[model samples]
Target: MIFEMTTQVRVSNFDEGRKWYETLLNKKPDFIPHEGFVEFELIPGCWLQIAEGKPTEGNGPLRLGVSNIESERERLIKELKIDKFEINSRPEVPVKWGTFKDPWGNHLGFFEYLDKDEEKKSIKNNLERTFN
Candidate 1:
Protein backbone atom coordinates (compact mmCIF):
# COMPACT_ATOMS: atom_id res chain seq x y z
CA MET A 1 0.00 0.00 0.00
CA ILE A 2 1.25 3.50 -0.72
CA PHE A 3 1.78 5.48 2.47
CA GLU A 4 3.62 8.54 1.23
CA MET A 5 4.09 10.50 -1.96
CA THR A 6 6.18 13.16 -3.71
CA THR A 7 5.73 15.42 -6.74
CA GLN A 8 8.61 17.09 -8.54
CA VAL A 9 9.02 20.14 -10.73
CA ARG A 10 12.08 21.05 -12.71
CA VAL A 11 13.68 24.45 -13.26
CA SER A 12 16.33 25.50 -15.73
CA ASN A 13 18.36 27.33 -13.06
CA PHE A 14 19.00 25.91 -9.61
CA ASP A 15 19.68 28.98 -7.50
CA GLU A 16 16.86 31.06 -8.88
CA GLY A 17 14.45 28.14 -8.67
CA ARG A 18 15.38 27.42 -5.08
CA LYS A 19 14.89 31.03 -4.07
CA TRP A 20 11.55 31.25 -5.90
CA TYR A 21 10.27 28.10 -4.20
CA GLU A 22 11.43 29.32 -0.81
CA THR A 23 9.50 32.54 -1.31
CA LEU A 24 6.42 30.72 -2.55
CA LEU A 25 6.40 28.27 0.32
CA ASN A 26 7.48 30.93 2.81
CA LYS A 27 10.05 28.60 4.34
CA LYS A 28 13.42 27.08 3.64
CA PRO A 29 13.37 23.58 2.21
CA ASP A 30 13.05 20.77 4.77
CA PHE A 31 15.82 18.90 3.03
CA ILE A 32 18.57 19.68 0.59
CA PRO A 33 19.84 16.22 -0.22
CA HIS A 34 22.51 17.58 -2.61
CA GLU A 35 23.40 20.54 -4.72
CA GLY A 36 20.73 21.58 -7.20
CA PHE A 37 17.95 19.66 -5.46
CA VAL A 38 15.69 20.50 -2.55
CA GLU A 39 12.50 19.11 -1.02
CA PHE A 40 9.67 20.51 1.02
CA GLU A 41 7.46 18.26 3.10
CA LEU A 42 4.22 20.01 2.23
CA ILE A 43 2.18 17.79 4.52
CA PRO A 44 3.42 15.04 6.82
CA GLY A 45 4.18 12.51 4.12
CA CYS A 46 3.65 14.56 0.97
CA TRP A 47 6.73 16.14 -0.59
CA LEU A 48 7.27 18.73 -3.28
CA GLN A 49 10.69 18.55 -4.91
CA ILE A 50 12.33 21.22 -7.02
CA ALA A 51 15.33 20.19 -9.08
CA GLU A 52 17.71 21.78 -11.57
CA GLY A 53 17.06 20.67 -15.13
CA LYS A 54 15.17 21.54 -18.28
CA PRO A 55 11.58 22.22 -17.27
CA THR A 56 8.76 20.31 -18.96
CA GLU A 57 6.47 22.74 -20.69
CA GLY A 58 2.87 22.83 -19.36
CA ASN A 59 3.61 20.26 -16.72
CA GLY A 60 1.42 21.12 -13.78
CA PRO A 61 -0.75 23.39 -11.73
CA LEU A 62 0.15 21.71 -8.46
CA ARG A 63 -2.69 22.93 -6.35
CA LEU A 64 -2.10 23.36 -2.63
CA GLY A 65 -4.91 23.55 -0.10
CA VAL A 66 -5.03 26.90 1.67
CA SER A 67 -7.14 28.51 4.37
CA ASN A 68 -7.75 31.61 2.29
CA ILE A 69 -7.30 31.58 -1.46
CA GLU A 70 -7.93 35.27 -2.02
CA SER A 71 -5.35 36.40 0.51
CA GLU A 72 -2.80 33.91 -0.72
CA ARG A 73 -3.38 34.98 -4.32
CA GLU A 74 -2.93 38.59 -3.31
CA ARG A 75 0.27 37.75 -1.48
CA LEU A 76 1.63 35.96 -4.53
CA ILE A 77 0.78 38.91 -6.73
CA LYS A 78 2.42 41.46 -4.47
CA GLU A 79 5.41 39.40 -3.37
CA LEU A 80 6.11 37.13 -6.30
CA LYS A 81 4.91 39.62 -8.94
CA ILE A 82 2.55 37.13 -10.57
CA ASP A 83 -0.09 38.57 -12.85
CA LYS A 84 -3.61 38.72 -11.49
CA PHE A 85 -5.63 35.54 -11.86
CA GLU A 86 -9.20 34.50 -11.23
CA ILE A 87 -10.56 32.28 -8.47
CA ASN A 88 -13.31 29.94 -9.59
CA SER A 89 -15.95 27.72 -8.04
CA ARG A 90 -19.23 26.04 -8.79
CA PRO A 91 -22.35 25.56 -6.66
CA GLU A 92 -21.70 21.86 -6.23
CA VAL A 93 -17.99 22.20 -5.74
CA PRO A 94 -16.66 22.30 -2.22
CA VAL A 95 -13.69 24.55 -2.81
CA LYS A 96 -12.57 27.64 -4.68
CA TRP A 97 -9.24 27.76 -6.49
CA GLY A 98 -6.86 29.90 -8.54
CA THR A 99 -3.75 29.24 -10.58
CA PHE A 100 -0.55 31.04 -11.44
CA LYS A 101 2.85 30.32 -12.91
CA ASP A 102 6.28 30.60 -11.36
CA PRO A 103 9.17 32.40 -13.04
CA TRP A 104 10.37 29.15 -14.56
CA GLY A 105 6.87 28.43 -15.94
CA ASN A 106 5.89 25.77 -13.42
CA HIS A 107 2.16 25.94 -12.74
CA LEU A 108 1.12 26.27 -9.09
CA GLY A 109 -2.09 27.23 -7.39
CA PHE A 110 -4.17 27.22 -4.21
CA PHE A 111 -7.59 25.97 -3.12
CA GLU A 112 -9.76 26.79 -0.13
CA TYR A 113 -12.75 24.91 1.15
CA LEU A 114 -16.08 26.68 1.15
CA ASP A 115 -17.21 25.07 4.35
CA LYS A 116 -15.16 26.26 7.29
CA ASP A 117 -16.08 23.24 9.38
CA GLU A 118 -14.74 20.89 6.77
CA GLU A 119 -11.59 22.93 6.54
CA LYS A 120 -11.12 22.73 10.30
CA LYS A 121 -11.67 19.00 10.22
CA SER A 122 -9.08 18.56 7.51
CA ILE A 123 -6.55 20.66 9.40
CA LYS A 124 -7.18 18.68 12.55
CA ASN A 125 -6.79 15.38 10.75
CA ASN A 126 -3.51 16.44 9.19
CA LEU A 127 -2.24 17.67 12.55
CA GLU A 128 -3.14 14.41 14.22
CA ARG A 129 -1.35 12.44 11.55
CA THR A 130 1.69 14.69 11.88
CA PHE A 131 1.89 14.34 15.66
CA ASN A 132 0.79 10.78 16.18
Candidate 2:
Protein backbone atom coordinates (compact mmCIF):
# COMPACT_ATOMS: atom_id res chain seq x y z
CA MET A 1 0.00 0.00 0.00
CA ILE A 2 1.07 3.56 -0.68
CA PHE A 3 1.05 6.35 1.91
CA GLU A 4 0.88 9.69 0.17
CA MET A 5 -1.37 12.67 0.68
CA THR A 6 -2.04 16.20 -0.53
CA THR A 7 -2.67 19.26 1.63
CA GLN A 8 -3.97 22.56 0.34
CA VAL A 9 -3.38 26.00 1.78
CA ARG A 10 -5.52 29.06 1.48
CA VAL A 11 -4.15 32.49 0.71
CA SER A 12 -5.42 35.82 -0.49
CA ASN A 13 -2.96 36.03 -3.37
CA PHE A 14 -2.02 33.20 -5.67
CA ASP A 15 1.26 34.47 -7.16
CA GLU A 16 2.58 35.54 -3.79
CA GLY A 17 1.74 32.16 -2.37
CA ARG A 18 3.41 30.48 -5.34
CA LYS A 19 6.65 32.29 -4.78
CA TRP A 20 6.66 31.38 -1.10
CA TYR A 21 5.92 27.74 -1.87
CA GLU A 22 8.70 27.61 -4.45
CA THR A 23 11.13 28.83 -1.84
CA LEU A 24 9.97 26.27 0.67
CA LEU A 25 9.84 23.29 -1.74
CA ASN A 26 13.03 24.33 -3.57
CA LYS A 27 11.38 23.86 -6.96
CA LYS A 28 9.02 25.49 -9.37
CA PRO A 29 5.36 24.69 -9.26
CA ASP A 30 4.88 21.43 -11.15
CA PHE A 31 1.16 20.94 -10.64
CA ILE A 32 -0.36 24.21 -11.73
CA PRO A 33 -3.86 23.65 -13.06
CA HIS A 34 -4.61 27.37 -13.52
CA GLU A 35 -3.44 30.83 -12.60
CA GLY A 36 -5.04 30.69 -9.19
CA PHE A 37 -3.82 27.25 -8.16
CA VAL A 38 -0.22 26.11 -7.85
CA GLU A 39 1.15 22.88 -6.45
CA PHE A 40 4.47 21.50 -5.47
CA GLU A 41 4.46 17.76 -5.86
CA LEU A 42 7.27 17.05 -3.40
CA ILE A 43 7.56 13.37 -4.33
CA PRO A 44 5.82 10.81 -6.51
CA GLY A 45 2.61 10.78 -4.51
CA CYS A 46 2.82 13.60 -1.98
CA TRP A 47 1.58 17.08 -2.78
CA LEU A 48 1.55 20.56 -1.23
CA GLN A 49 -0.71 23.05 -2.90
CA ILE A 50 -2.07 26.60 -2.51
CA ALA A 51 -4.63 28.85 -4.18
CA GLU A 52 -6.84 31.96 -3.81
CA GLY A 53 -9.07 31.46 -0.80
CA LYS A 54 -9.14 31.68 2.95
CA PRO A 55 -9.08 28.51 4.97
CA THR A 56 -11.89 28.44 7.46
CA GLU A 57 -11.18 29.55 10.98
CA GLY A 58 -9.34 26.80 12.83
CA ASN A 59 -9.18 24.86 9.60
CA GLY A 60 -6.05 22.87 10.22
CA PRO A 61 -2.66 22.56 11.80
CA LEU A 62 -1.27 20.35 9.03
CA ARG A 63 2.27 19.14 9.05
CA LEU A 64 4.34 17.05 6.63
CA GLY A 65 6.78 14.71 8.32
CA VAL A 66 9.82 14.83 6.04
CA SER A 67 12.81 12.54 6.37
CA ASN A 68 16.56 13.34 6.34
CA ILE A 69 15.53 16.87 7.23
CA GLU A 70 19.00 18.36 7.49
CA SER A 71 20.01 17.36 3.98
CA GLU A 72 16.70 18.32 2.47
CA ARG A 73 16.83 21.70 4.26
CA GLU A 74 20.29 22.47 2.95
CA ARG A 75 19.18 21.73 -0.59
CA LEU A 76 16.09 23.85 -0.20
CA ILE A 77 17.95 26.88 1.11
CA LYS A 78 20.66 26.70 -1.55
CA GLU A 79 18.59 25.81 -4.60
CA LEU A 80 15.52 27.85 -3.77
CA LYS A 81 17.41 31.09 -3.07
CA ILE A 82 15.39 31.79 0.02
CA ASP A 83 16.73 34.51 2.28
CA LYS A 84 16.27 32.40 5.37
CA PHE A 85 14.19 29.62 6.82
CA GLU A 86 14.19 29.81 10.58
CA ILE A 87 14.86 26.68 12.61
CA ASN A 88 11.88 26.36 14.90
CA SER A 89 13.40 24.03 17.47
CA ARG A 90 16.40 21.99 18.50
CA PRO A 91 16.58 18.27 19.38
CA GLU A 92 15.61 18.71 23.02
CA VAL A 93 11.90 18.02 22.82
CA PRO A 94 10.17 14.68 23.22
CA VAL A 95 9.09 14.55 19.58
CA LYS A 96 12.70 15.41 18.56
CA TRP A 97 11.25 17.23 15.59
CA GLY A 98 11.97 20.64 14.10
CA THR A 99 9.51 22.74 12.15
CA PHE A 100 9.47 25.46 9.50
CA LYS A 101 6.75 27.30 7.69
CA ASP A 102 6.28 27.83 3.98
CA PRO A 103 5.77 31.19 2.33
CA TRP A 104 2.02 30.69 2.34
CA GLY A 105 1.93 30.07 6.10
CA ASN A 106 1.79 26.27 6.01
CA HIS A 107 3.77 24.48 8.68
CA LEU A 108 6.29 21.73 7.81
CA GLY A 109 8.53 19.53 9.90
CA PHE A 110 11.30 16.96 9.97
CA PHE A 111 10.31 13.94 12.05
CA GLU A 112 12.62 11.11 13.10
CA TYR A 113 11.29 7.69 13.87
CA LEU A 114 12.83 4.81 15.82
CA ASP A 115 14.48 2.00 13.86
CA LYS A 116 12.01 -0.84 13.45
CA ASP A 117 14.63 -3.58 13.18
CA GLU A 118 16.18 -2.69 16.52
CA GLU A 119 12.77 -2.57 18.12
CA LYS A 120 11.86 -5.97 16.69
CA LYS A 121 15.09 -7.51 17.97
CA SER A 122 14.53 -6.21 21.47
CA ILE A 123 10.95 -7.37 21.52
CA LYS A 124 11.91 -10.83 20.28
CA ASN A 125 14.67 -11.18 22.87
CA ASN A 126 12.36 -10.20 25.71
CA LEU A 127 9.69 -12.64 24.54
CA GLU A 128 12.22 -15.51 24.31
CA ARG A 129 13.46 -14.92 27.90
CA THR A 130 9.95 -14.77 29.27
CA PHE A 131 8.69 -17.81 27.37
CA ASN A 132 11.74 -19.98 28.12
- lDDT of all predictions, in order shown? 0.92, 0.62
lDDT of 1 by residue, 1-132 (tens): 677899999999999899888988999999999999999999889999999998889888999999999989888888888999899999999999888888888898999999999999999998997787
Candidate 2 deviant stretches above 4 angstroms? 1-4, 67-95, 100-105, 113-132
lDDT tens per residue, model 2, 53-121: 864454445654454556666766676543454445555543334555554455555644345465467
Cα lDDT over the full model 1? 0.92
Steric clash pairs (candidate 1) = none
Q: Whose lDDT is greatest here? A: 1
TM-score of each: 0.95, 0.55
Best by TM-score: 1
Superposed Cα deviation of residue 110, candidate 2 (Å):
3.0
Q: After superposition, how far is residue 94 of candidate 2 from its true place, in Å?
A: 9.1
**Least accurate 10 contiguous residues by lDDT in model 2:** 87-96
